[model samples]
Target: MLFSSLLFIFQFLPVFFIIYYLSPIRFRNLILFLASVFFYAWGEPRFVILILISILINYIAGIFIERYDRNEKIRVTILVLSIIYNIGTLMFFKYFNFIIENINYIFKGDISFIDIPLPLGISFYTFQIMSYTIDVYRRDTKAERSYINLGAYLCMFPQLIAGPIVVYTQVSKELRKRSYYLKDIEKGLRIFILGLGSKVLIANNVGGLWDDMAQIGYANISMPLAWLGLLSFSLQIYFDFNGYSLMAIGLGKMLGFDFPQNFNFPYISKSVTEYWRRWHITLSTWFKEYLYIPLGGNRKGKLRTYINLFIVWSVTGLWHGASWNFIFWGIYFFVLLSLEKLFLKKWLEKNVILSRIYTILAILLGWMIFAITELENIKIYFGRLFSFSISEDWIYYLRNYGMILVIGILFSTPFLKKWYDKQANKILCNILLLVIFLLSIAYLVDAAYNPFLYFRF
Candidate 1:
């Protein structure tokens, strides 16, 4: 059930919004709660029970943690148990196959391979539930007395499928009391249309270029062609995931709930540390508040701070998937960040152009690892990126250079909205926006298949 799909845009979303708004304010939560359950179950019916069980377990755990607040030992025990339970469920569902496959390969163990069905949105909802329990344990938020309110918060369809990882603290007050204003709804609609346009008109088209370049065998890839593919993929992923985030935020606004901004023009960043601060702001904040802070953070000496930073990022990578490539991707960023903190900062400040070029190259290389799955293929791709493969022809370079330039320039700034807004005449802005909106719909209708990258994680 992709948000970009026609079924979602024309059918599910329209129907849900109409019914939800028409319902009594008192029954709004129930309407959304039931709709969310149906949304998840529609795609993976078998996982519905898993979702219920996990919700029930955490809800109970949260209550116990709140109940035994005076007893420090009891509170700690319950908190530890709840954390283990949530993580254990995640491990069994998400990583059991990943673990068994590795064991079989390393020791030639006679482990029978069994297909495990991954529940739709399990990673997202699980984290939501975990955050709730942890917050209750820390006394940051009270355990919700009403099961319905808590349930709705966990499985709210928009962020549930692919999230900005909304936590209990962010939405708890809104869940209890919220209002809908016409102005807010209008603003939300505009944001939604803009996000839809980004996904359909720009991201999907760039994704086609990425797919075309990928289909060209790696052996035929030149350094220029390699750079083109990397740049295309980098932009494709940003637009796809960030487009979805914008839509999610718009939906939250429409419902009179404010969701945090997930991206802050990350490509414009001069440093990896700054980039993380801007990109996926919610997730980085989560890791910092929960994992890094608990591990002593920067309150300790410089060496320990670096160690904690590395551990947090490594876990962040592993959280994305149970793959060695993701681990490398995490470490790859860690290395650059460490270097920037250690020596590159002063050097880059003195040489601005070289610094910018170096940062772009490092980021482009990181995206290559992220885009590919296998280690050997990544190695071969990296070799070509450095012109180690001499077989590529001039046609390859000429054909892709223009597309690469477009992607690079687009990713490098936030020009579209600025340019449109610069037209001081309101009528002109509205006319252009209307045209873009219609074109986006046409592009979406014409494309048979469009996929978002972050949905897998």
Candidate 2:
């Protein structure tokens, strides 16, 4: 049930929108919850039951935590249990095989790996539910007495799979009360169309170049070709994930729920610390609130603060996948961020362009790790990136992909929005928007490459 799929566009979404608009205002939450469940179940019917059980467990835990507020120990016990349950389910479904394989490799024991199927969106939805329970226990939000509203909060389909990690507090009020104005619908349509164009017109095309180059593998890569592949991948991931987030936010707008923004031109950041602030803003904030703050945050001494930062980021990386690569990526980031904190801050403060270049290079190198399956291949890729094994075919690929690479880099920054905003007159804007909309549809109909990256997760 990809948001960009033909069935979703023609069938599921249309039917859901019709029913939702026709339903009474009081029953809207119930309708939304049912639709969300249907959305999940349509993809993975067996796992829908598991998710429902999780929802019920967390929902009940939240109630108990609120009810036993006078007994701090009891409240803490319930909260801990709820978190453990959520994380335990996530670990079992997502990481069991990963853990088993690692253990088997480490020791000479032959442990058969369990073939556990990961439920679609379990990582995302589990975090959402845990945030709900924790917020209730921490007094940041009240426990929703209405189960229907709570269900709606948990299962909102827009951000359910590849999320902006919408917190329970952000849309709790919207769950109970929302209005669908014509203005909101219009704005949402514009945002959605822009996101669609980004995917179909730019990201998918650039991703094809990435895939084609990567198939050649790192062994044959010339320096220019290697750099081209890395650059294309960096752009592909940005457009893919950010495009998805835009669609999610736009869909939330159409539904009259104001989901927060996820990205903010992160590639423009002059430091790794700044980049994290701008990129995946929601997830970063969630980690800060739920994980970092609880671990004494920066209140601890400098050394402990660094340790806390590393641990939190390592967990963040592991959360992305149950792989050593992700863990290394986390540590990679931790080292850069720590260096900025400890020594480089003052030096970078005096040299803006140098700082920006350093930050971009670090991020690009980090993404090389994220893109590779194994560390050895990543090392080989880096070696090729620095070597001068230029070939005619590799140069041909680079020249062919050069224009798209430029467009992707431009798109990564804020220039497109600036240009779009500079245009005046409603009629002119609407015409341009219509052109983009038509092009998006045309691309969807004709494009050969349309990979949804987060679908793997």
Candidate 3:
């Protein structure tokens, strides 16, 4: 159930909102939990059981961890078991086939691959569960005694699919007690509409341009056209994921739960370090908190810090997908970030224009690595991007998609948002939002090239 689809927008959301607001305060969590389960089951009914099992395991584990808090070894053991259960389930469904295929290739063994369907949002919910158990073990948060509250927090439909990776402690209070207000509803609606417009009007349309260019074979594409195509993909991916994050946050607000912001105009970042700080802020924070910091972080000195970064990034890339190219994409940023930390940071800071150019080019090239999975195709595409070849098709695509590219680039910065915020009389602003909403509806109705890019992750 995509948020942009008419079925979700016109049917599921309206029904859920009405029932939720009308329900008695005491039963609200029950209402939300039921709705979330239904929403998850709507796409893949079988996976509901899998998710239920996960919630049950983590819920019970949290209680046991709290009960055994006086016994450090037992508490730690429970936490380890919970983590293993969550990650093992994720690996079985998401990475089992990936591992088997690689094994067969390496050893020339006939390993029969298991055909497992990845449950929707397994990556997201698994991490959420792990965070809860770990927090309990560390005594950072009390174990959630109410299964209903725990289930609601873990399976809330808005952030369940693709997430800002909400930690348990962040929303524990809201799960137990929350309030709704007219102002919150208004704010939430405005944010939701803005995200809808970004996804429909900007992301989907530019995604089509990228698809068209990709159909032009990599070998035949000229350098300029290759760059244009990759640029289009870069825009499409940013708007798609960021737009989804905004919609999730907006919905969270409407439900009287505060979700963290996931993006912060990352394209404007002048360094790879800065870019990671801004882009997918929640995911980066998760790795830093759960993985990097635990691995001694910078406290262990320079060599260990670099080693920690390598491990974190390698896993980060694998988290994105079960592909070698994604791993390369991770290492690609690792190299750039390492250089910046070692020496490039000083030089980049001294030259503003050059720094921006370098950052943009580096990010653009990284997108190219991310956009394709096959090594052969990636090699050919890179050849096209750097071959200095010329073709008429590049001009044709530019003429068609030039304005959209301009709009995408502009929105990637804070220019439009700053302008919107400066308006004192919000009548014009409201009117603009209405226009965007209507335009988004028209696009959704047409249902052209609408894909949630991060759902695979």
Best by lDDT: 3
- For candidate 3, the lDDT comes to 0.91
CA shift of 445, model 2, Å: 1.9
Per-candidate clash tally: 0, 0, 0
Cα lDDT of model 3 by residue, 101-153, tens digit: 99999999898987788788888988888999988888899999988889999
Residue pairs of candidate 3 with colliding backbone atoms: none
What is the per-residue lDDT of model 2 for residues 340-435, given as tens digits with 9 covering 90 to 100? 999997888899999999988898898888888688988898898888887766678767888988888988888878877777336888898789
Over 1-457, each residue of candidate 1 has an lDDT whose tens digit, in order, gives 8777778888999899999999988888888889989988888889888877877888888899889889989988888888898889888888898899899989999798778877777777778888899899888999988778888898888788778889999999999999899989877776777677667766787676567656777656777667777877877788888888888888888988898899988887776777888888888888888889999998999999899989987888778887888888888888888888899878887876787677778888888887788898898888888875545563554474566447546744877658755763477766766886888778777978688778778
Kindly provide the TM-score of model 3 when superposed on the true structure, using C-alpha atoms. Answer: 0.99
The TM-score values for the models, in the order shown, are 0.94, 0.97, 0.99
**TM-score of predicted model 2?**
0.97
Q: How many backbone clashes does candidate 2 have?
A: 0
The residue pairs found clashing in candidate 2 are none
